[model samples]
Target: MTITPETLIAAAQSSKAWPFQEAQRLAKRMPKGKPGGVLFETGYGPSGLPHIGTFQEVLRTTLVRRAYEALTGGAPTRLVAFSDDMDGLRKVPDNVPNRDMLAQHLGKPLSRIPDPFEKFESFAAHNNAMLRDFLDRFGFEYEFVSSSECYNGGKFDTALKGVLSNFQAILDIMLPTLGEERRQTYSPVMPVSPTTGAVLQVPIEVVDAEAGLIRFTDEDGAIVEQSALGGMAKCQWKVDWAMRWVALGVDYEMYGKDLTDSGIQSGKIARVLGGHKPEGLIYELFLDGEGEKISKSKGNGLSIEDWLQYGSEESLGYYIFANPRSAKQLHGGVIPKAVDDYWQFRAALPGQELDKQLGNPVWHLLRANESHAGANAPGSGDTLPVPFSLLLNLVGVLGVGATREAVWSYLGNYVTNADPAAHPALDALVDKALAYNRDFVAPTLAKRAPSGGEVGALQALDAALADADPAISAEDLQTIVYEIGKQPEFGFDNLRNWFKALYETLLGSEQGPRMGSFIALYGIAPTRALIAEALAKA
Candidate 1:
């Protein structure tokens, strides 16, 4: 049956994780008049292609938002995918080819990196644009915020001021957490200028409200100063989380389990800085086909692009929604298997439940199926196909054309069951087709080439057909064969053998579908011509 936001939320609350309950606790403390919203942030390092892990975060957040919307019967909660492009180039990623160039741009804002494609204004923009494009393809509506924009806009001024005022407090909290040796070098934040390695011993008077500048004294007691524009934010990485919650008014956020400890640190800092803790939801990591973490920087990861080429969007959605949002590991290569299972799930759902699933965004497979079904007839607007058999049958005939519309039409007419609601067998067939499409590559039609056995079978079939009525149709030919097979010597096994012999003679294969149906679709004359060609080759 169709799963709604309420259902998902209920599921989450019932599960051991209880994210919704956690969200409720946080929601109760928020300002009474303000609507509760979730702020889902994913960092874009701008070092390499965004892997499937990135999509997982965005997709999960979007699904949660959708569920919220469904439950509230209001506009879905806002989701912002923030790109941390203002962050400096800390180190050259292992997979990036241009280490020297990237290192040359080190300590500079990610917005300043040269575009690898040489088309975008900067490397950050190129990556950001790619991410935006990918999200757009999936119909995700997110507020795109660049870290550069936030820094340049002075949105973090108050937060920065708060951080500075509480610097001693932050130091006290971090000192015990980070031993004294580590705390000495750490000033609660990192400040490295493009022109200098470390701006140490700077005067505290460099704190400019208007210019967003913060100054400090280095170990040598020298005045070292830097502007907030130079990637200097209100707080360090640990403190930044707390500052972001206040600055963006974030209510809910989820992260990978790998960062669970860091999330706790951020939550603690948030309590100190913002007087409130950001709702932190922890999710599990994704593994490759072999159950290993999919690391993009390591040049080993499955991308959304890779999945989309073979799997349907619905399948992807199914992959996301089927599992609990808890810290469960996912197998990337087995995504196809997930998609296949999702189709089966949809097919098995009650009619009304399936209808509901079709209406939900998390049920992307249903949507894809609907889109395919709708495009079946020209000028028919979009409609859903009746059953999976139509799709499989159409694929079997190799009638799936260049356009999705063509494929849809072929499926609607030939593959779908006449009455899916009533026909159990037909419904089962549809499920089988969905499984095949989800798990395996679509089969390609064999090229015409008659083998020696095929030539012999075709000669015998041709002689038989010639002796029979000239007007005998392909269907009639099947009936004739059935009649012959009724003989004790020519039973089902022999009939199968006879058909294989005929196929071998005509098409160079000992296997094929019913000759009558094949001939009817291929045309009697074309069938004869194919056999003649095969005979000539023999």
Candidate 2:
């Protein structure tokens, strides 16, 4: 079927996906008959290596951009990935090397500081390169913008002058948000020192809006008058953000929940500069495995490298795409479920109606156009015949020392067409499962002795499996296991406990694959042996 722009736009208008919803919000703010269409911007601070959160912001913004394109019937759009490299480095980051050397450059712009690793022209340059590489590896289409270039090359001259003119207005909007002590020294403009090359945080003594200049006292008690434009000065954090939005005419941007107040204050500053503030989503921050807020300085959160090491790229995107509002514990443990969910969604997409398909996260992640449809979706060739969670459990049962060949041998029995060479995705999943089993599952595995009643149930299960045909279907086998559990003679008041006992005793885990599937995959004789081994423990 031919999918026209009207179908896509109708789907986008009615779709409840967060990206489409954000795009709908953005449509209201779009300027009438703007040249070069709409602009979407995402900010990055190049004080350190870009983390997954940075990638997430760009990915989320790109999602919205794609939805906007669909909403506007393929109107032109540009995504600017802005890096704030001109901001001062207040202190040394705990993650990087050469702490003593970096300490000397404190209060200097990140773009001006020496690279700790000595790879690029400046500290921020090294980090900026890394950020670009990170985004490039993910295939994100964006134009990279350097804050230092904008400030130093006179690109922000008019915006800087606007800030100078509205300095008082910005101060009024900002001062009420600060505490009593902070309000005393607060200034919208931060002049870069000519002698020291540090971004001065001192209060501005005078602002010449006409000449685009500011006067301030340096740290050495020297009173200085400096050009507010052409790299001589930069705005404070909130003001800088607002000035950027105004200068770029950004249509949309998104930030972490922690910065919601800052976004609001910056929006006010943007309006003060005679430019409209961009509409955006305020998403919750990612947390560490311990449920503490992820800090780049502390190196506590999962990096993009870490997530990709254990899961596919699509799985990582799926994890980020699920819920922008809810905080998530990002770690190694979440990868398996993410992989399974990604495939599950992909498999379901072909059957869903147009509206539901548009709402599906996989639709946005995989489909290029409405006509790209689920049957021929990009990356659909990589779908695994088996779920990632089942693969993980297979590795769990086979021990951490399980080999790829051994996994394929069992998989071949369950899925006759399952060939490691043909199923590259399955092959990769097997490797990830083995690695996860080794790192996370192996250490925690401990077989506990079964209760007296559970022993009887195990015996009954083993006997039942021994008498049944070895070629029974997985679903039929499941019925048998369910029936055994439901037997009043087994004394299981709750059916869940019966499965829990099986997992604890047989798999040494609190959770496991379906017993029917496990038995069918492991073979009836091997399962009987496993049951005998569990009974012998008594």
Best by lDDT: 2
| lDDT tens digits by residue: candidate 2, 281-359 | 9999998889999877677878887777778888998899988999999888898899999898887776777788778
- Model 1 quality (TM-score): 0.63
Minimal lDDT window, size 10, model 1: 375-384
What's the lDDT for candidate 1? 0.55
Report lDDT (Cα) of residue 12, candidate 1.
Answer: 39
After TM-score superposition, the amount by which residue 415's alpha carbon in candidate 2 deviates from its true location, in angstroms, is: 2.1
Alpha-carbon deviation at 277 in model 2, angstroms: 1.1
Window of ten residues with lowest summed lDDT in model 2: 367-376
| Index of the highest-TM-score prediction | 2
TM-score per candidate, chains pooled? 0.63, 0.94
Which RMSD values do the candidates have, in order?
9.1, 2.4
Put down candidate 1 lDDT per residue, 182-220, tens digits, no spaces: 666666555544344432322244366456566765455
